[model samples]
Target chain A: MKEIRVFSPATVANVNCGFDVLGFALDGLGDEMVIRKVPEKGIKITKITGAELPYKAKENVVGVAGLAMVEALNLDFGFEIEIHKNIRLGSGVGSSAASAAGIVYGINQFLETPLSNLELTAFGMKGEAVASGNEHADNVAPCLYGGFTLITGYEPLRIVSLPVPEELYVTIIHPHITIKTKEAREILPEQVSLKNAIKQTGNLAGLIAGLYEADYGLIASSTQDVLVEPYRKNLIPDFDFYKQTALKNGGLAFGISGSGPSMFTLSKGLQNAGAVEFALKKALKEKNMKSESYVSPVSKHGNRILEQK
Target chain B: MKEIRVFSPATVANVNCGFDVLGFALDGLGDEMVIRKVPEKGIKITKITGAELPYKAKENVVGVAGLAMVEALNLDFGFEIEIHKNIRLGSGVGSSAASAAGIVYGINQFLETPLSNLELTAFGMKGEAVASGNEHADNVAPCLYGGFTLITGYEPLRIVSLPVPEELYVTIIHPHITIKTKEAREILPEQVSLKNAIKQTGNLAGLIAGLYEADYGLIASSTQDVLVEPYRKNLIPDFDFYKQTALKNGGLAFGISGSGPSMFTLSKGLQNAGAVEFALKKALKEKNMKSESYVSPVSKHGNRILEQK
Candidate 1:
């Protein structure tokens, strides 16, 4: 295909218990992009809408990630990308990851021999790095591989796709505020007590096991953050109140979505998720904060073609 | 059923990446105990045969655990326990756990309304605390619940049972050395870098996911311990050589079982496990270290009735 339009879904990273390791993609909540093959040997961002972002090829995450994929393949042909964003920038719901993952996914489809999702994820991480100042896969991997993804190792970049429970739903609220990923990271302690570290791992293991078993109670109990949440929660207003609202409304788990400003709650069913969304939105409104809310089943597939030629 | 005899299997705790949280029970290698109900209201150690242990009920792990169970039940009658030792003391292969878990299992069999494995696990932990100077269920949970267990939360004490792959086998070699659990714990750093903590949880989450899916490759890759192994490996002589030998043979994953003196390796099949066992035994022999080794599939049952009257 010479041209392809794709939808790159938003993702929830850190996932409460799995800081820097786990993430899950969302359904029908993301950004759209159209890419066209060009004769030139470099990527260019032809247009962007809905959010103001860097337009330069070197500064834009979409361009940086696309270029990484092209350079790795040593491709002679370039691509022009037009992005239409629905996800808010710096909302901690993986706005940059949507663009970064979507672009590479589109480019890979145009390849004579398409790269694996794992490979696409690596290139997409370059774009994530441009935004976060770190080469982290917690967001990009799930956006590429879909469902839930676990980055088991970083030195060699091993990503594992996890089983998604059938009834799982997510309610995310993005307050009209931005918490820079770098600043959010700076608030964390460089060192953590061994006791807390063990607790975190236990919860992570339990969460992974619960996903496979489809045990909602296990998932709810296990979705706790001990390593990073305490420091970063302050970045989001009324974090505890919102979490209580979500939990009181049948949310299975609640935490800062990625680095904050946006928070997510997981629920067992669509109705429960909707209730959580209503409660969180109400809580946000009471706090006099402008916010956007989304209730979606965990996305089964990640980046996918919307139209192709 | 006023009297019951039970066989409580040995267990391997801290299974690599899951320190103080994960463990799996072993088959055929454990201790046998006989408990008799009397008109009295206290637990007593009637006879000791395997290894020398405290005869007083308060000092003995078997009595202490049984007393914990009886107190919770508010039993009007007490029991007498006879011990026949199989697992070695201070072997770090959960020798004390076998005794503690066995007595509780035997006593529960006599209860008109027996406690759940979860309740028995709590009682078993009391005995464990007497042995290790801490109430940890990594070993006891697996011993009571059978199969693999994850202690997800300690505050409210949540135990999760994980699936055991049909072909999974464990090879444990106990070198004739002793490392007290307290002294081994003291060697560990009170704090760890957040970077290392994240890596450990990544591996742990992967391991749990791998177990549920029975993906041996994922299990092999994820069975890594970063938090405690580095500091504790020195206590075990030739830890590196034995690990290399096991991995070089057919072991899927290898690590110090609990604290030290004993090391365990998991392999995919019985033949592969035997090969790892042979290689590890030979390596120990070459190093002039006397050791005992056992190869068995991950136990599907914990304590079980041997004889009853």
Candidate 2:
């Protein structure tokens, strides 16, 4: 194939109780990349659009990911990548992951030497490392795998795709603000009380069970965060107002998505999701905060080839 | 019904990564309680067997559970309970939960009132409180509902029954040593590093996914405990030897049963369970420690009515 275009979805990591371990992909809000094989045995970034991100191949997530994949697979061919970043950077919505995963996914398609999802994830992690100075896969895995994902172990890199209930809808409100992942992570406590740890563990277990059994009530009740949300909520404007407004208006569960500036709520159906979105947007409007909202189902396909020529 | 006999199975609490949040019931090890109605309007404990325990109604777990049930239901009938304790106390195998849950289960059967499982769990928590000075439902809930149970929340007392794969077998080795639950709890660190806490959360989410999907490899890999087992394993003699032996002899996962002297290992099949049991017992014998071992499938029924007359 001469060229391949792929779309990689955005993801909301943590999912309330599962900080740094659990995440789910969204049908909307993603990044697209186009890759074309070149004669020279080198990687290049041809163009960038939609968001202000680094353009230099070595500094860009897509270029870094492409380099990692080429080196890991020992490819002799060159490739040029075009980035269309739809997911916002510093929005806590896995924007970097979308670009990172999309480029690798696009290259794998163009070369027809598809790497395993796990292997692709490792390359994506390298991209994430370039963006955040840490190789974290919580966002990348879900962005690549689709649906809900659990990063069970990081040392050997174990990722498990969890079941997602069919009726689940996600409503995300991204205020026009920025909270870098590094800053959000630095504010977290070095240690947490055993009491909170136990509570967090229970919530994570309950959430997983809820997903497996398709129990919406359990999922709502279990999507509580006693560990990360308390510390990171400060970075988001009117975080409590958005969360409470969403829940009071029929949202099943609500929390700061990933690090912050972006918040999400889960609902059972489209009607409830619409209500939650309306309420959240109204609350942000009343506060005079410029924000964008997207209501989408949990995406089942994380990254996919849009076209090939 | 004039009288009812019920069996409440023993449970292993804090199943590795899920300290104070996860537990599973055993098939054969349990406490049997026979409850009979009388003319008086108060609860009483008439007899005790197999273990030395208090006979006073308020001082014993069975009586406390009976009292809780009676008060909650406003039942105006007297009851006499006979305890046949098969699960050893202070063996870290939820001995107190078995007794507390067995009596309430028998009482519920004789009355035919059929309290909801959550209500029964609440009453069972009262029983556990009488034994441990705190109302904990980790063990009691699993003993009441069977299979794997997750105590998602404590305020409203939420309990979720998780799926158990069919090929799983459990082997428990209970040594003749005592480690009080209170002391075992006291030795735990007041706080854990945020790093370890996040790791534990991931393992729990993974394990729940493993159970729901019936993935043995995921279960084995996710069964590791980084929070509690390292501290409590010291109370068990030859803990490292027994754990290593069980894993080497075909066990999929191994950990402390509850708080102390007893240890448990999970295997994929009967043959594996037999091998694990044999290896574990041989190791215990070599240490000059007398221990009892039971190999059984995961109990599907938490508590059951043996007979009604």
Q: List the residue pairs that clash in candidate 1.
A: none
Candidate 2: tens digits of C-alpha lDDT, residues B16-85: 8888888999998788888899888768888899999998888888888889888778887879888899
Instruction: Give the residue spans of candidate 2 off by over 4 A.
Output: A111-113
CAPRI grade, predicted model 1: high
Off by over 4 Å in 1: A38-41, B39-41
lDDT against true structure, model 2: 0.87
lDDT of 1: 0.91
Q: Candidate 1, residues A172-261: lDDT per residue as tens digits?
A: 998998788778878999999999999899999999989999999999999989999899998887889999999999999999998878
Could you give candidate 1's per-residue lDDT for residues B108-213 as a string of tens digits?
8887788899889899999998888888898998998899999998778899999999999999999998887777889999999998999899999999988888
Local error of candidate 1 at residue A122 (angstroms): 1.3
Provide C-alpha RMSD values for all models, in order: 1.9, 1.7
Weakest 10 consecutive residues of candidate 2 chain B by summed lDDT: B104-113
